[model samples]
Target chain A: MTDSGFKKLVLSHFWVAFGAFGVASVLGLYQVVERSGLIPALQSPKVYFASVSTHGVLMAYVLTTFFVMGFGYLVAVSSLKTPLWNPKLAWVGFGVSAFGTALAAIPLLTGRGSVLYTFYPPLQASALLYIGAALLVIGSWFWCVIMLVMYGQWKKGHPGETVPLPMFANTANAILWLWTSAGVALEVVFQLIPWSLGLMDTVDVGLARTLFAWTLHPIVYFWLIPAYIALYSFVPQAAGGKLFSHELGRVAFIMLLILSLPIGFHHLYMDPQQGKGFKLAHGVGTFLVALPTLITGFTISASLEKAGRQAGGTGLFGWIGTLPWRDPMVLAAILAFGMLIAGGFGGIVNASYAMNAMIHNTAWVPGHFHLIFAGTTVILYMAIAYYVWPSLTGRTLVSRTLPVIQLWTWFIGMTILTTPWHILGLLGQPRRISSVVYNSVLTLAWTPYELAMIVGGAILLGSALLFLYILWKSQTAGAPEANAEIRYAGYEEPETPVPVLLNDFKLWNRIILALMLVNFGYPIAQFFFTKTFGSIGWGY
Target chain B: MSNLIPVHPLEKRWIYVVLGVIALFLGAIFYTALVHQVHPPGAIETIDSATLHLGGEFAEDKLGVRTDADGHLRATLVAARYGFYPREIRVPEGLPITFRIASADVLHGMHVPMTNLDTMVVPGYVSTVTTTFPKPGEYPMLCNEYCGMGHDHMWSKVIVVSRESWKAAAPQTGR
Candidate 1:
């Protein structure tokens, strides 16, 4: 394929992804300020919920899906040294998803689907929104197939050689997504769509929630694996060091793929429908998922430490100071690591079945998730964009200094914003409140934190605008020569041949299938077998 | 092959250390849950959500604080769109009270923020949490779940009072 052809494929998807992010950022600012009720003019529950729902769907589903798809293409082409298999089908997927996004946006923007992103049923939205969401999932399925086909083709050609780590993980994510989305896909098609279109009088809320739980938690890893891919395969090289261990990276991905699927029931711990035994089983699996994250943290940190040492740093901890702080990717990895530590702690707390009651459904949950999803994952996405954009667009960035500025403001702003959010959750403030305008003493205690959040929101908004501006300038710039080459971090290959299980996924896929049946089979089957009640749709 | 680098022994040691720390953390959480009696929210019983208001323990007239078969003080509450059934709940202070909560509609979560009392009130199943409020006070119980358009206004309070005051007021039955 021509360079221009590949660039077009990558850039088209990225534009949609970033476009959604740009809109969501503005809506997020609106929510923080409106929730504060600091400005009476902005205080409206109807609008707040609408904006929140749109913001969530855009950020969680639209942005992550498109970005992952686009980035997966770049990884496939670069790592596999192959042209995109079935490019026409890839375009078809993009078109379908984009159309779906547009269809979903209509009801969301018009306040006709203020059900928030969870869309927990009995609270219904317009049929268009449900159909749009289903279409988006279907479109992503096309990307998954294309990815797997390319992966299989590369493996066929390479034979005994190990697949490139980036492509390996990318393909793993594609597989994970295909499995992860099946639960929600089943729910939307069989349960939500029919109920929303008014063809069904009543919908089973327990079954709907049970199915959603199957998808909910693993989908996070789908969004995250790209960020992790960048960390393992890109950041070490960007930081002027080798990957600490390539073997560890493969292990982490494999563990994540296997463990991420069965563990989603932890999200339903607070819910009534699932039994204690099932929740406990899922909780155990949830704790296991944290293992891979911890390993990633250690491996990446060790890689950076090696980089710092290579730069002539001495002493046990002095290596940290010697590493590159100016490189946007390196800086993002460092900052993202800091946020991940805090986020990981919060996750451990959330996964602890008993302690979850203290923070579940509170503002603390959002605080914890934002730190993970927005803080750690999204920052890495920015870093990946920064690294890849120049190569993809064939132009030098307009301003080098602006990216450093953007990363800092985002980190600082998130800290300022989420710190008070965690506190408010502890102080008895609920998560989805439209306003904290209550004049009571309990509500008044949240005033200072509310004010702090507004300031943080403003800073974050400015940072987001700066990010968009930087991307725009880079894309539009005219450079002397195109810089289309990508440099991934290198690590020492094992002197002995790497194990087949680490290299190929056939056995692992079989294992995952069995595990899924064992872990999820009974829980999902019981829903259909049991005497369950279906509730009628109420909300619009 | 040219770019490949070998893993250092020290890095391997660090990996072990990291894994050890993770193991310790998980072990601690399990210990607290199993040995320390820190239990999560859920009951063994299942109820038909559509007929919640019709019959059995969660029926409309049978909601709120009552004595269970085991002679334990049990409180039953229904979570639905816009409000919690028996919106006002009164429980005696300084007693181990088991709250049996369920949702009549979609997924709703009950969180009284100041206390270790938050659980999802989903349909078709009952979530139970046993706890004691040592201090006598009015704890505002907020529906933290995003139920619907009226979610913001879905606020209720649980009045925790002394046993003497509780007897004087009497446990009001039925919604």
Candidate 2:
């Protein structure tokens, strides 16, 4: 396929992804206002829940999956300097995923699949929802196969050479997704689908949860790796700096692949079926995963510092101010870092075995996730969209100032949104409630925070709409023959003679499989090994 | 394919510092659990939810303060659709109270709003969390998990009174 052909393919994928994101953003704002109990007409539990469920599925599943697939295609073609191995298969995947999204969205919008995007059964939804979800996952698996095949083709053609960093990370994520998604896939195939279809009278909810837990946490990394790829590959170059260490970047990717897969039991820490021993094991592994993030933070900061120094900065932190913040990519990185610091601290507390008592299932959990997902991950997605729009559409962004303002507004809005969410959680306000107008002293204390969240949600909604406008404007605006090309950050040093394992995922994939066996082997097997009761589906 | 610049010394040094901090955080988390006796909720416990209310420890009348053979106060509570069984649990202040809770139907999280005691009560197993109330006061306990439509109304009370008052309130044989 020609470059324009490739661009058209990826652009179509992103348009679908961002379209879902736009609808979800509006639904999210409606939820915040409804939950605040500030408006009477908007406060229906049925409507609120349907909106929440749709918003969650659209943002969490549709947006992230489609964006990653589209971005992966771009990365594979650009980094490998070749067309997609099978462009036809890619379009098929996109069509299947988009159709599946529509199938699931029907139930969610109609209040039929109001199980809150979590298949924590007995609270079951329509069979179509499960089948639709399964199809979405299955569609993405096609992307995985394509990514691996293209990666393999590249390595075979160019023997004894380093895989480009962006392609390597992209492939690692593909491998991670393949492994990480299996748990949920197994759950859907065995339990949820059968139960939802009424083929099974009762389903083992414990097994369902255990399997879902396997997919739940690592999937965050699935959403996050693209952001990390942009950080490592794009941000440094955008800032006029080289990566501090290419070797460290590879190590971080490896660590994420290995550690992110097996430590999902942290999500099940408070779960009763699992033993304390397993939870502690997963908790330790969860903490270990933090190391790679810390490494990323350090490496990225050092890279930025190097950039600032080259631009005549002095002193310890003064280099921060000297770096080019005008560039949308650079500004997004700085903003993402700020949110990461705050969100990472929340995550540490959530991961702490003892400290989890303070915040588990509270509003704090959502607060932390939104900051990480929306604040950190989506900001980078926004930046990447901006960075590549010119190449994809052969059109210049309508206004340079719009993107910078939108980024700042997103950052500001997220801070306003999550800060009080953390406080409300600490104040013992439970999450997943449609309204909090109980008229108690404790409920009264939550009112101010609820109002604050409404303000934040409004700002976020406005920012999201503005973002879509910019992207739309960019596509429709007149072409500029700027001939913008994909530019990845280069390493400061020639990488040390690296082993073949570091270059490719073949050995690493096997190692991850082994680690999963160790981490979850008995935990999952014990369910079948022992006598476990089944619970019938309850909610519609 | 071209030769890049050499690795920066300071960047290498900072990587070590970040790694070290991560190690320290891990150690600190484990130390509290292993040494300080600050255990995670449901440290290790399970119960059959099918028979939860029919018979066994969490049966209706047996849902309040029950003293073990060794004189440790154990509170057995069951969380269900819209409420916690034994809507009121009386515990003596200034002593460690062990709360063993289970979910009868779906997933329910138990949390004492004012205390450092919170845990999810999942069906098929019991969750045990141990903590002490330093002062005598009534602390509201609520279900943190979204069990169903009635999840918002799932609230209970943990009434912590003086030792003599708790003893007086308890049924003599049950204790």
Predicted structure with the largest TM-score when compared to the true one: 2
Off by over 4 Å in 2: A437-440, A495-497, B1-8, B42-48, B167-175
- The 10-residue segment of model 2 chain A with minimum total lDDT is A435-444
DockQ of each: 0.52, 0.48
lDDT score for residue A531 of model 1:
79
Relative to the real complex, the DockQ score for model 1 comes to: 0.52
| Model 1: residues with Cα > 4 Å off, grouped in runs | A437-440, A493-496, B1-12, B54-56, B68-70, B163-175
Q: iRMS values in order, in angstroms?
A: 2.8, 2.7
Docking tier of model 2: it is acceptable
Question: In model 2, how large is the Cα lDDT of residue A111?
Answer: 80
Per-residue C-alpha lDDT of model 2 across residues A428-491, encoded as one tens digit per residue: 8888888763334567688899899988999999999999999998788746745777878988
Evaluate model 2 with DockQ and give the value.
0.48
